[model samples]
Target: MNVMVAEHIGFCFGVMRALNIAKKTKERTDKPVFTLGPLIHNPQAVHELEELGIHPINSLDEAPGGILIIRSHGVPPDVIEKAKEKGFEIVDATCPFVKRVQEYARKLCEEGYRVIVVGEENHPEVIGIIGHTGGKAEAMNKRRIPVIEDRDRIGMVAQTTQSIENLKLAISYVVERVKELKVYNTICNATYMRQQSTKLLAKEVDLMLVVGGKMSANTSRLVEIARNEGCETYHIETKEDIDPAWFSGKITVGVASGTSTPDWVIKDVVEYIKNL
Candidate 1:
């Protein structure tokens, strides 16, 4: 079997920065370090961090006195304030792109534009961004953008991991109805590159393997993109999830992983396919 890897795969800059901050803090401090949430979407990466003495605590109350590193997904400002009130030293590892979206959304809200965040409603990133707006923003998925009120001005921002196509479509939904539509294309460049690369690679391979956490939004998006290109795609977290039967009659396989996926996991998936 010929195994082809996407031009862009594995950890992106944002995930790498978060991991570095967590690992370095673990190495330098005697204080127990806790992440406000899973540092990234990849479970294997979080487990590895745990092995290195960096723990993930879901809530501020769960953390003992120590440094609290905010995950790359970012959190609402109130979360930082509450953690500070609890006396935990904070290290914010929010992706710069995500922070930009939050800032724009907040500014839009303050300027009196109805804020519309284009992303999954329940996604941590979207929730965090909405918090910046004092919980006054609306998060919607690609299928529908809810019409809460007819307004003259509306501002739109996207979750950093959202597809550019989705952002554009969501903007189109509001463009005509609203007298003035403001939008910030806050989708990370790396995300666009990866999605495009995945689409291009998917067309050349018989079977497409998307290796990342099942909960990873970007990884799921990659699977959707591959399938949209008329290719059979599987989203797997590890080599163990690879089904040998799926490789039957497949001459060429394409491998693509999400931004949060570690290089080691990608290598294992690739090597497993080679052996098959």
Candidate 2:
């Protein structure tokens, strides 16, 4: 059997940056370091951090007082204010591309364009993008994208991990109803590359294996993309999760991973598939 791997699988710049910051924070202080959420979407990575005494807490109320690491998915501004009020040291790891979305959304709101965020409504990145719009942002999920609202002007931005095609579709939907429309293609470059590479590999392979945390938005999207292309795709967290039955009679396989995925995980999966 043949195994094809994506050219752009594994950690992106933003995720790497966030992880590095987390490691340095762990080394610099003895105080408890807590992440607002999993610093990255990968469970293995989170477990690795936990081993280093970096913990993930869901709420600000449960956070420790030492150092709070804001995830790559930027949090609301009020969180920053409140964290500071509690005297917790802040280590921001927000991706620059995400910050760009926030900037565009804020600008649109100030100029009177109804801020339209084209992505999942409750995604952490989507939440952060909305917070930047001064409460004027309206998030359009997969369901909401179809219903064009009654608005004169609309400004658009997407969650960095979303497919560009979805953003364009939402833009097309709004073009007719809104007198003026603006779009910031906020989909991260790495994400687009990963999607494109995955699609290319999926077409040639007999089966597809996607590796990353199930909770990861980008990883889940990869599973959906591969399956939508008519390929038999399985999303797995580790090599142990692979089903041998799924590989029966398959001559070629394609593998791809999310941004938070580690190179070692990909290597291990590739080896496992090759041996089958």
Model 1 lDDT vs. the true structure? 0.91
lDDT of each: 0.91, 0.89
Error of 2 at 258 (Å): 0.7
Q: Residues 1-276, candidate 2: write the lDDT tens digits.
A: 799997789999999999999999999998999999999999899999999999999988896487999999998888888999988899999988888889999999999888889888878999888888767798986687645566667888888998877887788788978678888888999999999898888888999999999889998888888887899999999999998999888899999999999888889999998888
User: In candidate 2, which residue ranges exceed 4 Å CA deviation?
Assistant: 146-151
Best lDDT goes to which candidate?
A: 1
Q: What RMSD does each model have against the real structure?
A: 1.2, 1.3
* Native-referenced Cα lDDT, model 2: 0.89
